[model samples]
Each structure stands twice: as C-alpha cells, then as structure tokens.
Target: MIARRPEGADMEAKLFGSRLSPFVEKVARALQLKGIAFTLVPPKSPADFKRWNAQTRKMPVVEIDGRRVFDSTLILRRLDQLVPEPPLLDRDAGIAARQRFLEDWSDESLYWYAMALRWSDANAEATTTQVLGSIPAPAALRPVLRVVLRRQLRNQALAQGLARLPLETVVDELGRRFDELLVWLGDRPYFFADRPSVADLALFGQLNVLQSGPTPQAERLVAERPRLADYFLRVDAATAERRAEPGRGAARGVDFGTTARGA
Candidate 1:
C-alpha cells in the first residue's frame, strides 16, 4: 500500500539512491519537473542498503516530512499529491491508465535489457571498474570489490533470464523497442503530449542508462535512432534547466547535508 504524507513536519525531502540507477533517476526527474526541492543521499556502504528501505534494499526511496516512501512509481505518486500544480498524469482515467501501463513495462521489462547490456561480459570489466571507482572506497579494496560485485550483478541478471539470452538477441530486441518508441513519439516532445508525463519519466530512466551508462551497445544502438537520442537530450536539458533556474534555489534542494557519509 502507498504511504500517506503526515502533517506538521518539515517539508524538506531527501532521496536515497545512486545516480546510476534508472529507477532513482525517475524520482529525481519528477522532483525537478514538479519544482519540488529535494536532497540526494547516495549510499556509501553495504549497510546503507537497508537504511532507507529495510524490506527491499532498493532505492529512489524518499524521506519527506519524516516519512519513508520506497519505489519510484509510489514516490512519484506521492510527490504529485504533495505538489499538484503541474500534473504528471492525466486527469482522464483512460490516459492515466495508459501512462501507468507504460511506466510499468519500462520499469519491469525495458530495465532488464539495459541491465543485460551493462553487465554483459563484453562490458562488465570497464563498467564495473568505473562504477566502483567512483565510490568512496580504499583503492586497494576497490579492485577486488569491483570483481566481486560484477559477478554478483551478472549472476543476478542471469538468474532473471535476460543475461542468459545471447547478446545479439538482446540488442535486436532493444532495437525493435526503440523503433516502437520512434513511432509513438513521432513529432511529440513526449510520449503523449508536449510536456513530459509519468510514462516519459519512467521511459527516460532506462534510456538515461543507455545514453550514459558504461555499456557501448546502448550508446551505439541509440545513435542509430536519432529521434530517440534527440528526445532523451530534450528531456535531460529541460529537467536540468529546472534546477538551474534563477530563483529555484537548486543548491539548497540538492544539498548533501550530513547524511551523505553514512550512505
């Protein structure tokens, strides 16, 4: 069940997750789109995994007014309620349902394709090295940790079925998905309208990984579809501008505060 916001507490929000996670990006993008301020709290250690969300050890979990909310979809829904001015979902029930369906497919299905490419043998070495190197770990421990984590991630993907598929198969399927997106998007700035909706944010989450993550396959595949690349760029630029607006107080909203060291 979704948690309801409590009254009479500080309204400031804090997000706990890594930028590498597309799920986390979804929540962050929502905050920017809504003009709501939030602090980012990336996990710094293994123990940090369970800090924000004990049940899932997952991220994009949000703490607002002293209440903890997990899952990007739920987080976005909660934020929509707190600051409803710019609606992220359509008021029309049919449109809203379509948006929700797309978001779910992106999160549950498209995400695995991105993960498969990211942790595949061809990309694993370079990807893990860079990803682990960015963490605040001792240099000596980083190399060994990187190998261990990469294996674990790759195993998880294999067990999930995507990683077991041949890389060629994964790439071909991803290409087809991109083609579908091109047709749906056409000249529209977003999936359904000029302004981004929840579906757009959810789709962008995985696409962000493809564009910026360590996997070369994603970058190459995206390059083949110029329209998709342009759309992703547009979304990135538009949302980033929200944080840089003159009176938005971007720094304050994104301030690290003191919780960063712990997680």
Candidate 2:
C-alpha cells in the first residue's frame, strides 16, 4: 500500500534494486525524468531479496514517505499521480492508450525474450558470471551463490516457455519484434508523443540490457537497426541527470539517516 503524502511537502524516495534489472532501470529513469532524486541501492546480500520487498521478493521496490511500492508498473502510475509535469502519458486519449500498450509490451513480452537469451546455453555462463560480479556479497559466498543463482534464473526462463525454444528461433522471433517496433514508431521522435513517455523508458530499459554485456547477439541485433540505436541515445539523454528538471516541490520524504548498508 502507498503511504499518504503530506500535502505540498517535499518528499524523498529510496529505490532498492540493482541496475541490472530492466524494471529497476525503468523506474530509475522515470524518477530521473520526474526529477526525483533517489539512491540506487544494490542488494548487499541474498537476504535482501525478502527484506527489501517481502511482497514479491523482488528488486525495484521503492520507499517514500513511509510508503513502499513493489512492481515497476504500479510505481510509474503512482509517480504520474504525484508528479504531473512532463507526464508519463500523453493527454490525448488515443496517444495515451498506445503508450500504455507499448509499455506493457516492453515489460511483459520483450523482457521474457531477453531473459530467454540470457539463460540460453550460449550466453548462460557469461550471464552467470555477470550476475555474480554485480552482486555485493562476501568473497567466500560467491561460489555457492553462482550455482544457486544460475539455477534460479534458468529455471524461471525454462518455465516461461521462451527458454524451451531453440536458440536460433528465439533470436529470430526477437528480431521480428524489433521490426514491429519500427513500424509502430514510424517517424515519431518518441513513441506517441514528442517527449519520452513510460513507453520510451520501458523500451529503453530492455534495449539497454540488450546492449550491455552478456548478450552480444542481442546487442548486435539492436545495432542492426540504426533508428532504434538513435532511439536509445535519445532516451538515455532525455532521462539523464543533466536533462532532469528539478521537481516543482520535492521528493525528500524518506529519512534514510539510519538505513542499513551491507557494504
């Protein structure tokens, strides 16, 4: 449940998650776009999985004004209600509908494709290594964590149905999704609007993962489309700190003076 906001008061937000998660990336970019300053906290140990977010036991959980928000989609929706400027959705009904659809597609469908690629036989080892490298854990724990983490992720993909397909089939189908996006984007600077919407942020998160190591094939596939590449740069620039506009009021709601730090 979301905490009630003090009317017209400044608030602060604490986002507990690793940047490796596209969902986390999407929320981080959304906060940046809204000019909400937040710390990008990486889980210090395996236990943080349940502690940080007991509901889903997932990263990307956010805390503000005694409110804890789980799930990226809900966070974005709550953000739009709290901070109205540079809205995440267009004012036009038709435009907003399309933007919402694209955002959902990015999170639900595109995410699984990337996950399948990550846990595929070819990239699985590299992906495991990267996951271990990103974790802030004790040196002694790395060995055990590697085996456990790999199994958990691979199992997730396997159950999701995409990972069960042949590697070549997954790659080809993913490329086709990119083609569909190009058709949807057409010549627009942003999806359904001149400014970056939740859709753009969502797409950016998935694309960023594709380009960032562990999936060279996915990276190359993204690079194959120059327009899509430019979209990446544009989205990155728009939500970056330099482009972030100071919120009209504030997000200094959370008092992190005594929050735990594993590092």
Candidate 3:
C-alpha cells in the first residue's frame, strides 16, 4: 500500500447529524481518516432530520458539492471515491469481501445491540440526556423531547428484536460479538488490515457509542477485553487526529489511553 496521504482539503463536504449517534461517528471518522476536511452540520431541531434526509430521516448524511447522501456505508464509499489513497476497502477481492461483511455486521448487527443497550431501561435516562444535550431545543421542550425520543428509539430497538430481551442478556450477547470481533481481528492493528478500513470504522463507531458516557453496562463489557479496548484506541489514533477539533467538525472519540471503560 502506498503511504496514505490526505486529499480533498478543499472539498466542501458537510455532515449532518448528531455526533452522539454511532452512525454519525462512523462517517465522521471516515472523513477524518480520508484527510477530507468537512463541516459537521449538527441538527438545529428535530426538523433537520427530515430536511437533510427526507428518504429515511436518519443521519450522518453527507453533502458533497451539492449532492446529499445518507447512510454510513454509502458515505464511506463516497469518501473512497473522493480520496482513493489508502483505500478503506482492500484491493484483494477476498480481503475486501471479508471487510465488507464485517462492516455490515458492525453496522447492521452490533449497532442494534449497542442501541438496545442504550435505550434499555437501565440506561435510558442517561442516553436521553446526552442526546438531548446536543439537539439545541428550548429548555421547556427538553422534557417533552426526552419522552418522545426515548419512546421512539426504544420502540425501534424493540422492533429490531434485541431490546425486548433482558439487559443482562443484551450485555452478554454483545460480549460474545466482541469476542468474535477479536477473533476476526486476530493480531492485526486494525480489523483485517494494517491500516484502518470501513470495518474498523464501523466497529469503532459502535464501541464508541457503547462507551461514550451513557451505557456503563456496555462500557464494562468493553472494559473486560483489553485487546478490544486497545484496538479502539489504535483506530482512533489513525483516524481521529486531524478532525480532532473538539466542538468543530471532529466528533469526540473515547481515548481509552486516558479514560478506562469503567472509569
């Protein structure tokens, strides 16, 4: 692989979503790692959701030049197209296929597990507050938004089939998934590669949210696995540097190097 170089410094890319969302973080990390400088367009109200992405209303939407794109996977693909250096997908067909599967698993499977835990009874209040904190709603409306958001997300998690299970079961199953992730990761610095890829970014996004201050039960799950925790940090170091602009374009990343999972 060629030495990775940042490109599209002048690219006018704007990401729409709350950084707290794992899906948003997935795309944000991809942009930073790709060396693409972009603005993060945080939602001004709940209305921005449908406004930015009328099709799904879910976020981490990317607007390049003028074309808007939603979904984390598609956003990463767009990044690769814009800056092909240090590809997010491998050149080898087999490896790329494995990476793609892992990426989907992280997004489609692990994501729900993380979400189920986040919206679980034990963590709902904390999750609600953390999410509402970023929404810029009026003070009086916070309580109303809190109830609506919590109910809506919990319903979605229930519909997905994981939130119905007991929190302990969710935590246990998530641990097993983490174990399999380590197995797939083996001794590589990043998942299936010496460099970061969509797979690593996807996994990082889920793990990032699980430990991002709202889910202590899930955080403890990661705390038990030193390798998985370290892997999270390595991926962060690789991708989160340039966009590390605190309240700016960069979404905050958990630095396990400083903050332990349970800390």
Candidate 4:
C-alpha cells in the first residue's frame, strides 16, 4: 500500500495522479507555482485505484488541508484563491475568457489527439511492455498480463475513435492547432498576458507532454516558440524548489521522477 500523509495535517497537500496525464501535471504545476507543500502518491495497482476512487472518483485528486479537490481546472482556481499574490487567472474578463477557451481546448479537444497517439499499435505495445516490466508480477504471468492490457487499451482506442482515425489526420490537426497558437501568441511571452496565468499553465502542461515525446511537430513548435519552452522550464524548476524545502511546507512538490512511469 502507498503511504499517505495524514490528510489536513498542517500545510501539506497530497496529490494522487498518473504522471502521463496532462491534467494531473496541470494541478502539480499549479501547486509548484504557488509554493504549496504536497506529496505525490502514485497509484500503481488495483488497491491504489480503490483508494483514489474513494476520494475523488478520479485521478489527479488534490488533498489540501484534508479537503479534497477534483478536476484540474478547479484545482488551478483553488490555487489562485489560496495565493492571490501571483494570480493564475487574468483580471480582465475578455482575456480570462480567451485563456479559458484555450485551456478547455487543450483539455477536451487536444486530449483526443494524445489518446490517438498513445493508443497506436506501436505506442500501445511499448507502453504495455514498460508498465508490466515495472511491476512485481510473476515472470510467467507477464505475457498474459500484457495481452490483457493491450486488448483493454485496444477497446479504449476504439471507443475513443483512436483506432478508427488515421494518425496523420490527428497529427495534422494538432500541428494546425499548434501553428494557430503560435500565430496567436505572436511576440508575446505568454498566451494572453505578460504574466503566466492559469491558461498558460494548462496549455503548457499539455504541450510539454508532446514536446517531451516523439512528436516532430510538437518539437518544432517548441523550437519555434522558445519563450514558451523557457516558461515551462521555469515552472518546473520553481516547482522542484518548492517541494525541496524543509518541513511540512517542503513536501509541496510532486516528484515526477517517482511518477515517471505514468508518463
């Protein structure tokens, strides 16, 4: 069983999530940006699954001061409310709306593209091998487990239209959207404002996943938009610093290293 710090104990927060999920990363980045103390508990088994579902019925559940917060967007808003100094949401209504639109697009629209990529035959096989290799399952059972996982993933892909759509079509769509984002940003350092806002955090988390992977278009976009890439790096470093501090508050950062398997 994964060890959980006492909920609502002092200033510490605990997050249950998978590393590969951009939504989880969004919440983690927000906590890091705000210098909040938290523990990252990776759910590695069916038992861990039950524990997480009992709390929020979803992954990326945030336990702050013993209160549980679910949904990545809501978590960002909560962080903004908690730390008003550096607001993640813009003050202007129009800009905030635009920012939110982009964030929503990333979460709802772009997510399918990522799903398509992850569930591709080659990617699925690679991920299955990686996941099974990490667990302590008996060597004899590994192949059986792998087949089950692959079939399950295939079912999911079909349900999500991932298996039906051509990868090129998905990639082209993503590339086009990314190009639009670049053009929209123009010369600005961030998406909608001079400072990094919730919108920036949301989009950055999603795009960062792509950039870190084998997506050539994602890499090109990052290279073209160096400022955005730099922004992500800064956020990551800040998050690490906040998590590395001493005492209860020091526990705020989620260690991506430990949860890297989810990625």
Candidate 5:
C-alpha cells in the first residue's frame, strides 16, 4: 500500500508464452503483482518456439538479467528472489506449505478439466476456431492447424484420464473444486489475505481459462455459484490494467480508469 518506485527498470524481463495458456498467465500475473516490468512475446511458429526452448518445449519462460528461466513455479520462485519486496509466499512455514499444495493441485489436477472441456467434441470446433484465429498462421492453413492442434490436445486429455470421463462427471468435478475454493476463501479478498499470493495467481490463471476461454462450460458452472464467479472477477479486475500494458511496471496508486476485465 506504500508508493515506491520499482527497481532495475533497465533490465526489463522478457516472457515467452502464448496468450491462451493458463500457465503463461500465471507467470504474467505474478510479474504484475510484483510490479516488475516485462514483455510478453509469443512465438511466431511452432518451430520458433522449439528454437527458444528445445528441452521442455513448454512456455511461460522468463528471461531476466541475461538468464532464461522456464516453468511457472520456478519462474515465480526466481521472481521472489529478484523482487522480494511484496513476497509471494508467506513467512509462516505452514501457510506457505498450504499455498504451494493448493497451487500444485490447481496447476496439475484442475487444469486437466479445463483442457478436457476445451478439447471435447462439444467445444472443440468453437474453441479451436477462436484460439487459432489469433495465431499468425496462414488463413488457408488455419483449419488444418486447428484440427491437428485440437486432436493433439484431445489426445493429451485422454491420456491424462479426464477426457475419458463423461461430460457430466467432468463438470461435477469442476463444480466440486469451485465449491471447495469458495468454502476455503470464505469472504476474504484473496486465498490467504486481502492481497493476492502465488496460490491465488495459480488458481486465477486456470479459472480465467475456464470462464473466459473459448468454451463456456466452466463459466456456466460458475454462474450457479456467485462466490466463485465473483472471485474470478476479483482476480480479473485486479489484473485488468496490467493485462493492457504487460511490459510496464504498475506504479503505486495507479488508477486504471477503464480496465479490461477478462481480457
């Protein structure tokens, strides 16, 4: 709540990830929350991404101080070290442990449900069309790329065991998770306190994907539960301004008059 200038403005971080990825969003939100300046750069093509990260072949990579770091969790850990003023983890060991546990569950388990919903036959065409439309692929090749990407994601979901379940089952599981979060959060602004934490960022990323992504299944499920819906909005509103100018550090007491919620 205090006004202070962010340090190392000259060393602006560079992030490698697509807009649609929740994992990428997780890192982006953390950077915003920490008031770090960073640029989000998406790959021009699959081969371009392969050249950047040949190992994991994943995104949300952060390049800082001439060093590149990959993985959302690891990127967050590094950010905490780089910008330690507003710490992401709590000082209390037990609270920190719980935050990490929830983050892991949200990232690994809850994520699959969103994937399953997006890639399922019910949502595939619409989701693929919407997502691929933003990619810088040729108009003629978009349809083919969409089919290939959708099929690959569907295969991943199937292998992960979520896509094998009935649609109702997936929805029910998602609902249960939402209910659990509502109960855990109670009336608090964040998962732990009035301010957001790493756990909040992790869950918010997935919730954003579910509620605002191409498929409306998760959003529809949230509609039946106002608390969950409001929580999503809270995170969305908090990050709205930062989403607009991700490369700029948020100034203390900065007023973003017209924020783009769910952008």
Candidate 6:
C-alpha cells in the first residue's frame, strides 16, 4: 500500500519524472525506503523544455526545502546526508570504491544496453509513436516527427557504442555482464554489503527496466538470479512497510536540508 502523508508534518516535496524511467524510480524507491515524503510529477515529454530548463535539463529533478537537485547519484548522496543511519556506502574505502565503480557501470553501460533493447524490440515503432506523439506538434509536421524520432534512436545507439555491434553481440554482452554480476553477488542479501547500498540501487534500477521490458535475455537473467530478485522484493516490501505506518512523520516529512545544498 502507498503511504499516506502525515497531517501535521511538512508538505511532501515534488519530483518530476516518468514511470518508465529507471533512474527516477531508483530515487523514488530510496525516498520511500527512507520514509521521506515526496510528490511525483510526470515529465511532459522526453523533450519537454520547461521541465528540463528548470534544473539540469533532466527528468527526476527533486525539489526539497525549496532547493532543486538534479541527477540520480547526487540525489542519493543528498539523501544519505539527511539520514545517515542505514547507510548506503560502506565505511571501508576499498570496498566503497569498488561499489562506486559498479554503480557507475550499471548506470551508464547497463542502462544503454537496456535502452538499445527497448528501441529495437518488436513494439519499438508503436511505443515510440505513443511517447513522442504526446508532444504537441503541428499536424502537417507529424511525418517530420517520425523522422526525428528514428534519427534520435540511431543517435542514442551511436552514443552508447552499440550502433556498430550486431544485435546478437549486444544480447551476448548483456547476458555475460548479468552472469558476472550474479556470481559476484553470490549469496549475499545485498549487492555490496549486508544491506542495500548505492550500487544495489543502481543495479536494481537498471534490472527493473530489463525485467519489465520486452527483452528475453533480461527475463532469463532474472530467473537465473533468484536471490537478487528476492533482494528487490525485500526492498519493495520495506518501502511498503514504511509507507504503511501511521503518523511516522519525523523522518517522513523532513526536507533534504542544508547538506543537500552542498553548504
């Protein structure tokens, strides 16, 4: 069940994002897990300038205590400062470094792979039309919009270094990475530590995309990593529990505060 806002606490802050965006979902899940209060707002479109113009030209911009924070990593860091307990980073430097490396890889490399799969799937053309069509474009310019979207997909593939790789190669590499990550995680309850860390958040976000999308390899990977799937389920359950408690506004309704401003 979704948590209800406490009556006397501070009003929940706003988050601009889309349901399909894994990055946004990651931040939202973090907030939910931390018992932080927030309101969600969907971005107007992928190219909605009004939403992007306000901050880092990105979706998932978080407004807290009247300050806006952009980027998922920075937002997670800010949340850590607000609630240091149940830490997201390890105290050990070496381990933390490794976790950070994996986090970065998941965010960039894995995310691109997921995107590639998404764009090349059988439903690609229909999905693209639905998402892009929402933008208010001139009737006479609809054909131009289609052309622009195709080019954008091509550009995204090129940017991710997957444009030159054959589709089979892309699938193989993604499968290989998933296998390696599962083996690395082993029987641990979390990816990098005894509890969920930033790395887990990053991995879970990307993995959620793969599982929800029309990718066969992604589905296979999840099936192979039953423990990892359980970890995600636990995280979701924790969030739900935190949301279910009545009048637990101490942490729930507080702001990200000065630390979020880098002050």
- Tens digit per residue, CA lDDT, model 3, 80-141: 98778768998888889999999999899998998888898888998888788778798998
Report the error of model 2 at residue 9, Å: 11
- How well is each residue in 18-60 modelled by candidate 2, as lDDT tens digits? 7778888888778877777676678887689799888889888
Between prediction 1 and prediction 2, the one with superior TM-score is 2
Total backbone clashes of model 5?
0
lDDT of 1 by residue, 74-155 (tens): 9888988887756889877887887888899999999999889888888888778756854677777876788788888888
Q: Which pairs clash in the backbone of model 6?
A: none
* Candidate 3 lDDT: 0.80
TM-score of each: 0.87, 0.88, 0.90, 0.79, 0.88, 0.78
The per-candidate count of clashes, in order, stands at 2, 6, 0, 8, 0, 0
What is the Å distance of residue 93 in model 3 from its true position?
0.7
Stretches of model 6 off by over 4 angstroms after superposition: 1-11, 47-50, 53-56, 121-123, 126-147, 239-241, 248-263
Of the pair 2 and 4, which is ahead by TM-score? 2
- Model 6: lDDT equals 0.65
Candidate 2 runs further than 4 Å off: 1-10, 243-263
Best by TM-score: 3
Error of 4 at 57 (Å): 3.8
Q: Rank the candidates by TM-score, best first.
A: 3, 5, 2, 1, 4, 6
User: Tens digits of per-residue lDDT for model 5 on 58-84?
Assistant: 887888878899888998999888888
lDDT of 4 by residue, 92-142 (tens): 999989888988888877766766766676467655765564455678877
lDDT of 3 at 151: 89
TM-score of candidate 2 against the unseen true structure: 0.88
